[model samples]
Target: MKFTLLLFPLLALALRSQPRSRTGVTEHVTLNLRPGISLETTNAGAQDWIFQIVGKWSGFQDGHWGLELGDAPTAVYWFFNWDSVASHQEFTRSPEYPATIEKVESLASSFSAPHVPLQPFPPREVFASPVVSWVTFNLTGVANSTATTNWQATANDFLGNLTRVSGYRAHSSGWEVEDSRVFSVLVGWESAESLGAYVISRSFAEGFRRLVSGVAWEHRVLRVAGYVPKL
Candidate 1:
């Protein structure tokens, strides 16, 4: 009875000492941006608008998201990071996104629904890095097996070179389990500037095209340092 009484107080003290803030945390999300749209159109205007916002406003405090563009991605795949929901709320209410309440309502209609929410499949934990340079190429008219092989090969070459350029590098890709037709790649870089330099550089840009040519990948989305998986 005496030992139990002593242990209870220690356990209570430990629990009280735990940190309460959830800031600098990351969350995974799968947003169905334009699920029902036909290939001809998928709210290109809205997509572009959001892309602009993400590029400019995101990564403000070492918090960002990643995108997984399938052959027909609807802008759902993303990872969100923030010190906490409070910062996010502030950002949403900031003059950048909504100068006035009226303007906010007017532009709000553009979203598919719940613009940024937790992903369907929960991640083990948010990556330690605040940013990840990533690109998603939509595969066109290629077999699943072929797409994977092509992606892996491209990853092998690109990751090695990128790592050499910058000491930090990692690459990941996954084919849609539901339909082998879709595939996506996630590449990491220490800084967004490094990614931009490589993307536009003649030497690296053409290599990207050549790598995806066989699989006929379309460069749909290029996102800056966003999110990475912890486990």
Candidate 2:
């Protein structure tokens, strides 16, 4: 399950711009589990809280929740599509917010929730896949206009190639508004085995080197099984 070359980071910068009919945003939440806390316990607690929100909150479009895999696996990630940031903020002020947080807080040592606007919002089917690969890239140095443009081209090409791979279900990406230098990608696959196979392939090795060469950056990739709450 560990391949040094296969672990190369993928994609950076936002996708090509396009018009949108409505404003939308995806909230990325990471909950790092407390020591000795099991994923099953955390998942059950979180799922109950999410179910309540989805059922009552009108802004909740769709969601994908899963436990992180590989290095630093003691975390759970949730990607939720909301109507807008304002709607999410409204949810925070709701009466149910504090009780929900209290339920999940016991299992998590720390957590972070950041929102990004994904151009051409991802469909519900993407997160519905068997496995999802969430990757984040943090630009190491100053990201000037020229360097960013070049990186965009390379990143887009790499993302395009990923779609051609077998078992690739869907892909969506965006840059965090709070921190422009931070980029995120969500790619769905039929299975973790397929993703593992693709990562070790010769093509991945070449593409990875091309993407990261001379680009001072740090990245993390987490493979997680798609979680669909029974409503």
lDDT of 1 by residue, 111-197 (tens): 211112222112212233333543444555556766667666875676556655542455544443223354544455555567567
**What residue pairs clash in candidate 1, if any at all?**
23-83, 24-83, 28-119, 29-119, 31-76, 132-225, 132-226
Q: How many collisions per candidate?
A: 7, 0
Best by TM-score: 2
- Regions more than 4 Å wrong, model 2: 1-22, 39-46, 70-73, 214-231
How well does each candidate superpose onto the true structure, as a TM-score?
Answer: 0.40, 0.78
lDDT minimum window of 10 residues, candidate 2: 7-16
lDDT of 1 at 220: 29
Worst 10 residues of 1 by lDDT: 112-121
lDDT of 2 by residue, 1-231 (tens): 111211211101111122222468887877777777765553565656655665478777777777776644787777778777666666666787666666666667666666778865844666767677776666656458788778778889999999789989988888875567777777888888888899899998898787676655533345554554423
